[model samples]
Target chain A: MDGYKGFLGLLVSSLLVGFLSVIFTLIWVLHYREGLGWDGTALEFNWHPVLMVTGFVFIQGIAIIVYRLPWTWKCSKLLMKSIHAGLHTVAAILVIIALVSVFDFHNALSIPNMYSLHSWVGLTVVILYILQLLLGIFIFLLPWAPLSLRAFVMPMHVYSGLLIFGTVIAAVLMGVTEKLFFALSGYSKFPPEGVFTNTLGLLIVVYGALIFWIVTRPQWQRPKEPNSVLLQPNGGAQEGAGGLTVNFSNVDTPDSKLNHEASAKKRNFTADEVGQRSTM
Target chain B: MDGYKGFLGLLVSSLLVGFLSVIFTLIWVLHYREGLGWDGTALEFNWHPVLMVTGFVFIQGIAIIVYRLPWTWKCSKLLMKSIHAGLHTVAAILVIIALVSVFDFHNALSIPNMYSLHSWVGLTVVILYILQLLLGIFIFLLPWAPLSLRAFVMPMHVYSGLLIFGTVIAAVLMGVTEKLFFALSGYSKFPPEGVFTNTLGLLIVVYGALIFWIVTRPQWQRPKEPNSVLLQPNGGAQEGAGGLTVNFSNVDTPDSKLNHEASAKKRNFTADEVGQRSTM
Candidate 1:
């Protein structure tokens, strides 16, 4: 079950990321040609940031989806444990790639000293993503962890995805319009052919809606049963509704009849033999 | 209660709209001054579209909030209904104002024939916004309508807001950077107040986030109890330990003794009851 879910997560993430990357690349190329007059030198320099960030976001998405899947069902502990480690490793690598790209751009482009603030702020997002990734992995490994831990991790993944996606989109837009990296290179004045970025944004909106729906669904369908193990010690009653059984003789004594009547009222049961049935 | 809520809603809407109008007016004055030096005209025509749209959005927002207030709670149905009708009248007036502004701009602005498509698109948005204002007023009159109806109204509001906001932001950026409008007038160069337009884009992003949060938070919390009328049919029997009582008594015979036995074995009774029973 774990393996199947993990693979499914990987497949979905890959498809989304791959499609987004192709769109981003095409936009960058088009923008390069129109804005820069098809200058080859300008094109080479402008492509780095777009390529690097797209790659980082793609990998980071895979890591997040993998970490989130186990919550769908119970799975083998070993499988859960290994996937948890694997997600973290991928996340860390993506973060490192993001960091290296930012630093390399800073050195290569000689971006204005004042614009360093943008770079620093962008780096902060990478750091936050890495921290969220680590925490998610840790929570996944803890078998007895509360559901809230998983809940908390999901939002971090969402917010980080937004930050990363927003940053890259902004960078690409700036690159297209301003020729920020290569003054000689230019791209299309028009928007890219594929509306993937807009679609991706829509997808995020849908994902958020789904999360809200799942979290708030009514709980009345599942009622909590009593803890009978403490009373029986040997866990003896195991075959009735949700492993519970009636023991009528225990409540038949005259002294207990009033108490039993109150219980019967609460359960909406009229006094009858069938209610006395017990499981093994 | 309805009157109070309506009053509060009106107050909030008025304040927000008034404040946004002032902000838009101030931006217009500033941009007007910048555009005047080039055109030798007292009023700069370029700022008109942006100022009009901003003012329109603020007005629509006011109409939406006023229409949604729980006014039936506080007054006689006749009075509440009258107030609802009055609010719609005010919203319609604002829509008329928006329509006139769009038509005025359409007549004034001249572009290359190739750019006629852009102008048509711009006019389409204005028409859509006017339609939305009408639809919003309609929806406000019928608050008890299906969720799907409310859902349908929202996209018109959102998409129109986005289109107008996007156009104004893009125009402002182009005007500031290329001095596009200034070139047509006589201005040499303009300062980078395009950053302020970006700041306005950020405000739209913040506004979108807040709206998304408001719409989705209830879904994230437990679905609200299907309104009072829906609940009134059921006898107010508290379900189990919670208020959600689902009666399944018809599924099987009511067996009092057996029910008591079941409840006793399951420890369904309160702690105080157990103590009282022990004494008995």
Candidate 2:
């Protein structure tokens, strides 16, 4: 919102790229990994990667970038929070289904689970992801935590969200590779399935890189509102953060003995004037 | 340098993670991919993953983080640039060798080159990487380009370096998976070699995530010098990026009809004073 030049273009491109990756992953899962069928056998394993990519990677990217969209800047903060948390909620459910499919498939085949590094890292990331969502809601969305604690955890929430996103993408890469190796380990001189799977993996990587780059570009951060300054820890809000910030902390209702003649231009003042202002 | 509280810990941890990944990768290549003896055959292909990870992934990571190390900040900027570029040069050579081995093995076996998505993406990343290095040197280290152009491209150069680094990591993941799938397609459900290769892949992913996270953290950026602000695209340097900026654009070199008593703290100026400044 703070003038991320071409933000719309970038967001659309990110969504398109993410969609392409999901499609490629689905193709690999359905056509190559296992045919699309719910016979309650190994065919159920096909749901794992497809759902993981769809819910975890593609939808997850959307949830992260939702705030950066310029159109959402003026919407109420709570509304945006609901939309954000809602998307993540759905994504988490899909991830659950994805995980269940893998587990059920493993049990059906009498194969072991969590034995591969992919399983170890994948489960770790998903758990961390769930914790992140819960904590994000507690700190930023819900009013239970004090503003000070929310301020303190906000930076980490942002950082860890990105970190987990990257980790999940990496886990997906490893999972596909493991599957490929497991499925077609003895093909002579690179088979056709190898090309398809490698391409799908490549798309996932590209999709991830694009979304990370778009999300992290410093200039793209949503501009903070003047009232939002109160959200900053210690009240030392960013003044240079584009847009003329007006501090209304000292202003009070006229009935509260407020000076009616105070100059509007001199908005910023020390904390001495705090209680003069009326509560919202 | 401006108080990334646990920077030292993060840096140390990053290096350790990267080291572990490289060692594991080397183990996989040596023990499983191909034996030590080249024998003028497929054994040469062993060098591909080992050399790629060593040069492109591991050493390249070190090269990227060199700028982030606060201990080196006060050293001559030119020295840092040389070290950064020099490390990248070595990495590029190793990657060339890695590529050569793959091509040699492919040709020896009458297998095609650039046939898979891995080849396409891998080759593209390398080409972009080579161009990025050359462009970085020409625009930054050398004084050939005008300062305006240099400033304009500086942000992009930084961004693209990280992007290509990520793309290459993705390519490596795909390559290893394809190789695993190709080489071990018929193993009995999760073989030992698959475990080794999969674990190595996981390490690489973790290492990439750590390094990327470390490099991108804004607060962790190496603090700029007083004169560094002059490096801005419009030749207008930032005052104290935190606060307390001063403007002294009008101050002449002392005795040249200059006001000798100009306030030292008043060095930060507004936009009106921009064009009066000289360029490199």
Candidate 3:
């Protein structure tokens, strides 16, 4: 399969920026704010940013890009799906803890919870992330699921995953903005703390944009494995009615469903479409 | 010629939420804060949100999706491109004024400017937006340009347009959060103003998500015109090297270049490839 030019360079930049965001958040909380702890105090509140950057932004980004990694290309589809789901599960767990830390800090200080736009959007992302993970496991990882249903659900799955990732990035930015206003008194004066945190926010945005660019590129998408056993309705010979199970799930977004439409009819590729395929 | 199912419904919802976002920003500035002005008061700062919502979020979103509208399908591709660039031009002008308002407000108040993360991201978006606009005009809207160059630049043009739109929405949300914390007293108590502003933020997010969804759907993409004059290298038969200008820009993100590759080679579509085309 033809791979994207500069794929490695972009992927490396994405990870480099992603790790920088996590490290910056860690330093912001540890050195500028207070060190993290489990107590129901501001120290515990520090855990929120740390966990969020680690889980939601960094780990979740990795999960989204894992399928596109060239090293993973040779792995079984089922194995790749496990790594994807497992990373997401870890991210969800950390995000859940991060939420609890915020709520606990609010309760301890008698500050209200879920009052800010950041909270509203953050909660929505968390809920959607969880639902996406659950549905993904049930439909994609489960052995007994029908191929047609997977094909039907694949595009929505990819789209929603990207949406959730984007929403999370937006919410994190909102939270960063809100925090600077509340915590930094001389923030408007461009204090060192303010400048450093602003850089962190920029890094996060750049990292996210890079991830989106990498994921949405037609060339970088995970290629369809027509011979994968899991793509069959029941592993071996129990193909779906009308041989719909023969339509392999492309796993690429925006056009996956379209390809599904083509393959569901069991059509063979022509030279023109082969050129189109290379474009993808 | 098949159009997307429920395209109209989604388009309507996108506009509705987008307009609601603008309306909510208006109310927040007018009723909650002081009325708009140009005297470099906080009232003058009010134009920041108003112009941002009207131009960047609402109109900019419409510009991004204008091609996807069904009624506009009858319009020539050149005309549609004009409307697209024209709308973006309007958006850029308003955004410039909005930037002036903020800088003037800050200078008048003896407060520093471009200190906050919001400002950093907002300024980056504005700069990139202007660059995208200029390049778009030169590459896409102008006559006598080579069709090959247009095809080469179209994907980056669309990708950057969407990226700028998303970044603008994120910056706006960050600004909204910063404003709430700065202006509203006891905001954590969830005052009526805070709640209203929160709803506005959610509306903006929903509107952005809807626009992204509508724009990215393969079925809703602008159909390629195989015989359009504008697609010719120099119009009336001065075709480019290797007859490359025969490749029509699909005007669709993520896959347009793929279709271009398919067409540039001048291969006929077989039945299998035609099915794949429907997927696109």
Which of the numbered candidates is closest to the native, going by highest TM-score?
A: 3
Docking class of 2: incorrect
Query: Model 1 over residues B207-256: C-alpha lDDT tens digits?
Result: 33332222211111111111201111112111111111111000111123
Candidate 1 has an interface RMSD (Å) of: 18.3
lDDT scores for all predictions? 0.33, 0.63, 0.71
TM-score: model 1 vs. ground truth: 0.45
Q: What is the alpha-carbon interface RMSD for each candidate?
A: 18.3, 10.1, 12.2
Q: Write the per-residue lDDT of candidate 2 for residues A196-262, one digit (tens) a residue.
A: 7777767777777777656644344444444322222222222221000111111222222223322
lDDT of 3 by residue, A35-140 (tens): 8899999899999999998999999998988877866767766687789999999999999999999999999988889989999999999999999999988877
Candidate 3 lDDT score at position B131 = 99
Give the alpha carbon lDDT tens digit for every residue of A1-280 in model 1: 2234434554555555545664655564555343222123434443444443344444434433342342432443335436645654664574565445444544565543213213333454456656755664555444443332333243234434433443433332332223321233121122332232333333332232232222111111111112110111111111111000111111111222334433433342221111121101
Ranking by DockQ: 3, 2, 1
lDDT, ranked from best to worst: 3, 2, 1
**What is the number of backbone collisions in each predicted candidate, taken in the order shown?**
18, 13, 1
Model 1 CA lDDT for position A162: 37
